[model samples]
Target: MTNELIQAQFGPRAMDYVRSSVYARGESLGALLARLQRDPIRLALDIATGGGHTALVLSPLAKRVVASDITGPMLRVARDWLAENGAENGLFCQHDAGLMPFPEGTFDVVTCRLAPHHFADVGAFLHSCVRVVRRGGCVAVIDNVTPPEPLAVRFINAFERLRDRSHNFEHSLPDWEAFFSTAGLRIEHRQQFRTPIDFGAYCDRMSVPERTRTRLRVMLLQAPAAARAALNPREVDGRMTFDLGELLIVGRRAAR
Candidate 1:
């Protein structure tokens, strides 16, 4: 049921992600590229490669890149987009993030960007990443994160689910660090950035129902002071805008 909801929500909107300015252009991408330039990447795996944006970015840096997604339609759209962009080193695979089909030590680098919130078991996903990457290989993750406050976390996740049922939960920075430690990956780099989201475009991306959209707006407007302060919702030129907290973390698999 969870997989079905994810596919249903993302299949038709694959192109939107392919063209999304926020996803395609970000300081996180620049930072990832800088790191890649410093180290050599022979083979890479991109988990849940929506629209293949990350794969496209990695194609030139790595000898080969496998863009894996659980949704067939999403993978198809991503493959087409990659081909259209003349990216020859990218291969699309249909597989779940929690349970990848690749053998152990199959990749030099593994990346999941802007998609971990949809994962049902982020711990399992991290484990899979550690298992597939060779010793001392890198795993880069970028996703939206929640504040540590319980009220803020609850309100933000609730609002997100209202907009997109596929959303699971956004993990906090501490949660990510703990997961990495448990998975036996050493944290090499970490950074946070504010990503501005246009509320109208956000709702439209998921094809949210009008009633739900109305409710979301009301929730944002009537949220408690803490929630409002955490989210910082506001109106800009007749459109609602808000900033989402995003984290970029790079961890390396243990050598021993």
Candidate 2:
């Protein structure tokens, strides 16, 4: 699906993902919520904010939350979600990850969870994150990544593209570090996070076709032993059960 087509895909399933424990309580949002609960925070910008999971968790802790996405329907659904959830501190706006419509140094904290890989330009996205955050403010990012091994990276990325056309590329650790450093954001914390996915639910989330899903399953099943070892495809009841990996990267904007 192109970005425009998938834009429609997200809002319709917004509630589905919001209610899904796999997504809401999964790796990225879970870590973000944990950090907020442990400390007082204010004035956050949740980039992408698909399903509003990150915004919902962080809104209550902040004085104000500006959750932005390129998709209008998505922002609408997120606005509705915040209203119903008693999170009056939050607000929504249309924004592209590669380019945002906000003034500089406006927010104390910024977050992009499980959504960066969809950006057609990752460097521009990170720099935009840096631009919005105030000096000494924190920026948190979360996304799936492949291991450094060449074969493993190619296989994982290719499978993801087959399953979800909107997927761009999952950056490696060095790529992230270099981007953040040059963007003037210091890496504050890094965690290799994992979230399990039953094969069917994962495919369905992206609305993958039956034929493509079958192809993905066969690819995983027949993967070279080394590749399979890295991906570790598993099954229960003779059906594909699990295969997913994620990462959480927390950074601090340079002190002015």
Candidate 3:
């Protein structure tokens, strides 16, 4: 996907991310804090920080935290949000995930939460994450992942793309492992969560057209066995709901 498209898709809807419960308070965010509590984080970077939640959370832990996003409007929103939260050390930057301008070993920790799936070249983004972090520092990512089955992968990706034009491929666990390894980061921590997504709210978050919403509902209700197995689609209290597989993986740069 082009950077222009990504900016256009997310800039105007930036506030929606701030209001999103999934982004503002997710299990993965808690997991991140728990895992990094004991580590020393002097300078941290939060890439693709849509609403600045991760960066804000990292503020009290790291001596300084930089919230970076490709969308100018997103950065502005995040900057204001972080300031409102009294994150005195929080900083803002506008940059592409795949092409960070920071020097090598510039940060003690790097984080990307629920945003890598939109990256055009996930490997390049991971490499940039690894490159910017100091030796022995960790790069953490939390994002939706697809099932290993090829059919399910295709179906889920199609389902996502139907809602948002900027939607990109959500890779499988194995693909992420390979990408991390190839980027010179060694696996340190890994966890998965069955993230519940309300079908209606999900569509509304992207402002999906009414006709497209109908198609999405049909896609979920009539998904293939593999897709259903992966998503765990079902109805709850007259509302359609499903689980999206989210992986929180942490990889550390080799200390050599």
Q: Write the per-residue lDDT of candidate 2 for residues 192-219, one digit (tens) a residue.
A: 7656677888887777889998999898
In Å, residue 111's CA in model 1 sits off its true spot by 0.1
Using TM-score as the measure, which candidate wins? 3
The alpha-carbon deviation from the true structure for residue 87 of candidate 2, after best TM-score superposition, in angstroms, is: 1.1
Expressed as tens digits, the lDDT of each residue in 1-256 for candidate 1 is: 2888898888889889888888878888888877767678999999999888889889999999999998887798889988998999988889889989999999999999999999888999999999999998999999998887888888989888888889999988999999999999999999988888899898889888899989998998898777787678898898899888889999999887
For candidate 3, write residues 8-120 as lDDT tens digits. Answer: 89999999998899899988899989887879899999999999999999999999999999999889889989989899898888999999999999999999998888988
Off by over 4 Å in 3: none
| lDDT ranking of the models | 3, 1, 2
Q: How accurate is candidate 2 locally (lDDT)?
A: 0.79
Candidate lDDT scores, in order, read 0.89, 0.79, 0.91
lDDT of 3: 0.91
Clash pairs, candidate 2, are none
Better of 1 and 3 by TM-score: 3
